[model samples]
Target chain A: MNQQETGAGEIKISARDVQVHYGDNHALVDVSVDISDKMVTAFIGPSGCGKSTFLRCLNRMNDTIDGCRVEGDIRLDGEDIYAPEVDPVHLRARVGMVFQKPNPFPKSIYDNVAYGPRIHGLAKNRSELDEIVEKSLRRGAIWDEVKDRLDAPGTSLSGGQQQRLCIARAIATSPEVLLMDEPCSALDPIATAQIEELIDELRRQFCVIMVTHSMQQAARVSQRTAFFHLGQLVEYGETGQIFTNPSDPRTESYITGRIG
Target chain B: MLWLTFLIIVAAAALAYVLNLRAARRLWAEGARLHSITTFHALYALFLAALPAFVFVVLWLALSGPVIGALVLSGLPDEVRAGATAAQENLLLSEIRSLARGQAFGEPEPWKAAAAARLTALEATEGWARLALVSLIAAAGLIYARTRVSASFRARQRVERIINGLMVFCSLVAIFTTIGIVASLFVESMRFFARVPFFEFLFGTNWEPQIPIREDQVAGAGAFGWLPVLLGTMVITVVALVVALPIGLFSAIYLNEFASPRLRAVAKPVLEILAGVPTVVYGFFAVLVVAPALRQAGQALGVDVSPNTALAAGGTMGIMLIPFISSFTDDALSAVPRSLRDGSLALGATRGETVAKVLFPAAIPGIVGGVLLAVSRAIGETMIVVMAAGLIARMTINPLDSVTTVTVQIVTLLIGDTAFDNPKTLAAFALGMMLFLVTLGVNIVALRVVRKYRELYD
Candidate 1:
């Protein structure tokens, strides 16, 4: 387990010296890391620590931001995503993302889940689309509650249910990697528990990278934890060692709630 | 003299401000804590000094001319006063006024010369008297205001109350102006209805409002039916909407979703400038360019086109309206949260699909409200139709046929030397009343729809 950064799980994404500059401000500095597949890799730090910025970089989400410039190399499964030949629209379908807020489209619950599959031509007919929606909802652990009223607006759900719906929306694309940006920050304890359980179940199918503010969440749900502070990746190791025996003073100070 | 009086009032107010500022500062320094700030105390003193004097001066200026006229009228010779009728007396007064101005008309009475001299003396006295009174009132008001400025004086509260009253007055000014217009329209419409049956005017299709002005002139007993006029207005409105809706909506979509920041920065203001381009200019464009082009196109296509085609006016009006509809739609699109845009884009949906599927549906209420408001505007538009559309009251929907709209009819009926007592002139008022009601109804519904669904996204 201590042999290499890739270890046994197999590298899903490998990045070297990835620099993110938002206009004059250099937001992320020389971040180099290898993330394994079929596991939850958590990025944790205080606010404005570039944790979310790194998560967005995985899917090229930073392309949408004005004045944001990305430098260096980021590869998903030996393929450079930022290549000129690659379309962001096509790449986003392969790398799905869930935002911190439960931003369900102002549409019915069924339409919300079916949106990704429909756009990507995953369904051959109406019934196939319906099947995809039901399967996605079931996998999201929200089918039992929303099965009877798929016509209801996605925004009509509780905060926790909405987050789960967002998860369903993300996975409906059937991407290889799922990026979750503080998915539990807007939810209560129960909702957070449900999402944590879902994350564990989801690790079998997709490579998951999440940005979390709570150190406990990173420790509980993640096998690998990366600590970021002031746009720098200060530490990266096994979650247990990072929390119990941090190698960096900043990471130790942050974990003990001394400094952010 | 009036401006000099104004200068004195302003000087008095300034003096009051300076004096009260010193007084309030002394009170604060003497261990008596002030209730309001020093500037507010000074402003309060200024207002007290200026307001009453201003009111008195305005009243005195208004009353002095009439009072002086009455005095001059009474001073007329007994023979002239006793024999003259009211009209004759008014004539004599004007003649005397002109004589005082040294513009002596052809032969004048000797008593008029005496009266003009008296008028000059009275006018001079009136100016000096007003100035003296305004100074005295301002000085008294300043002294009284200064005496009232104690340590516990709530000068800020008083000044704030005055400000609140001024705001209320301004709002009432707008409300009352609207009410006055509606009331006058309604009253005049009722007068028109006394001569013509209300239902007949509303429902009858024949809208010939060309009644004979003189007994010898040959003219029909003008029918006041608004149906043809109303139908023509509808035709033009439909044509305008057809031309404007797609262009405006697509432009808004492109500007919001696809255009680069640099293009948007340059384009948005240019679009707004289109809105600011005077409607009269649009009218000229319709008459000088679009009308002639349509006629030639119609000739080439072997179709009969009127010189003043409704299509010409309606299409140019539509061009004029594009910026309005586009800006409104752009605002509604922008008002949708950035989170939704990010959500849709992150789903791998292209910008077009995202705007069409997610943002357009979300912003439908606002867009519909804007369209309805624009419809009302099209109905109320005057210059384009007056410049390009026909004056004939034809009951035809064909865009190529010459047709008259309500606004065009109103302009024609009101501009000439037609007597208001007849149905022809009164018909314009009736048409105006109808136009007002229809547009008012549309605007109300539009506003209500926007307000009702505006909170759903939030």
Candidate 2:
């Protein structure tokens, strides 16, 4: 697989000259990329290489962090997400996020899935809300395990189930883009495989953007891969090409498990 | 003599520590592997030398008083004992004790003088006996511990066991003290109930705890109705909660969610300083400032307000309790994991919405617990109510009306040198028992609520 073969989907999110700083630390340097709709784009890098920082900029999640500042342009569907007139709350509803650790709200499983929809007012009635919850949970691939105990606390689930619940919560609002920050890093191999399969199926609807430390995960799940080094984008290409062909020595070293 | 024995025991323990440490070191040096460290052996030996001697001294001191009293009683003239009640006999014994110390209050009776001399001799003998027995016990303990400090001895385990036993003993002392207080209240309340019916005290709306000290007094038979005082406590507590809960909880929310780190650092301590203000100072503030201001405001509004109103006291008490509620609520809100807040925010919930829906629900148990604790504090508060609220017990719920709480009545009943045998002083104990039960109930409920919620995050 190469960039030409995977370049058929329309561009969904376009970032240009993006930089991020945390107080005195210049975290992410000027990086530019175009993310396509109905495709999974993976950002792979070493620890603190700004892979996660770049993912947070997609949905403006960095806005929650104190002393964190983002510069340049990040647009979602041709609209500037960082525009002064844009409300981060409404922008976040359209662009949902999943964190590295499975962070389910301390609420019931049903409420956890319904939280996003309830806040966004997606459902017209109780039945519609229930249908949305069931569909989202099924889409998250943990509905059967948690179906019998919908009223149980979300935190009471296994770690894998909790992560799936968080995914369901994110998608319940019918988001246009899904930003996942190391979604499978905290899970075992089996749970990681399950999430990977779910992500593969999810790309048919929403543009999926992910940040991961595991090159094998990027190779397995993502169609396109972006490698970051020293807070800079080292390479941007298809996952297969990034793994098999040498475009940049840094990308080759990180993928070959030598320099990362 | 007892102090001398204590000092000697301490010195002996120190010496035993040094000797045992040297012995352990010598054994280790001689290619014999000791089971425990030298320090453990030293500490074990020190405890052995000190504990048995300390126990002996305490036992002697405790029994000597009663034993010497019995001996003195027997030595007294038969005429002094004959036809004397137990109370009168106790008086004679105390007199003999005072005379024995050569601090006679009045002209000493001949029999008492002789008894006092006999008591002095008996005490002297007992003191010598105690010194000999304690010293022997200390020597025996030191020898036994020295023998046990060999290569095979488990000094560490023995020392740990002794330390664990000491910890258990200290905890037991605390538990026993609480039990003792409750038992004393129960006993005294029983005495009060004997004269006045318990039903009257509990159900009667009128409360006047005046009892005549002298038989010739004209007007001293007072009613012991507790309903009015209890009602006053309820009204004040309600007012305090109404004033405190919203302000405390909102400030807690602001501190946890909105305030920057620097603002929190500056504001939180300033709010907590309200708690550090002495209740007496709050009392003066209530009486001198809040009460007059309230009275003038009421006059300006053309609403009749008493000089000492429940509103003034309760409002000041609420101000005093703001820090308590805010700090506790702040702790609970902050304890809600950052993950929950982030999760809510990621779902497009605003900060205020996230706090109200997610953070508040998660911290509900702790918030309720804090409020309950504040309610208990308000109920048991004394100085502010005494200084600001009226002393006439009235069963009215109007905030502008004067009211007196149970604590105020207890203070008044117990003030000065009133005879404990009368109903007036004893009624204070009854009121105390009620107050204790109410606060205990609230505390138990609060603890349960807090424990239940603590498991949510974990």
* Best model per TM-score: 2
RMSD of each candidate relative to the true structure: 3.5, 2.8
Evaluate all candidate structures by whole-model CA lDDT and list the values in order. Answer: 0.91, 0.90
lDDT of 2 by residue, B9-86 (tens): 998899889989999999999989999999999999999999989988988899889988987887777877789888
Candidate 2, A1-260: lDDT as tens digits: 45433443789999999999999999999999998888999999899899989988887889999999999999998999999999999988999999989988778899999998888888999999999999999999999998999999889998888898999999999998999999998999989999999999888788999999888889899989999998999899888888899599888888788987
- Model 1 docking category: medium
lDDT over C-alpha atoms for residue A201 of model 1: 81
Query: What's the i-RMS for candidate 2 in angstroms?
Result: 1.3
Each model's TM-score?
0.91, 0.93
What would the DockQ be for model 1? 0.61
Chain B structural similarity (TM-score) per candidate: 0.92, 0.93
Which residue pairs show backbone clashes in model 2? none
Highest-scoring model, DockQ = 2
DockQ (0 to 1) for model 2: 0.66
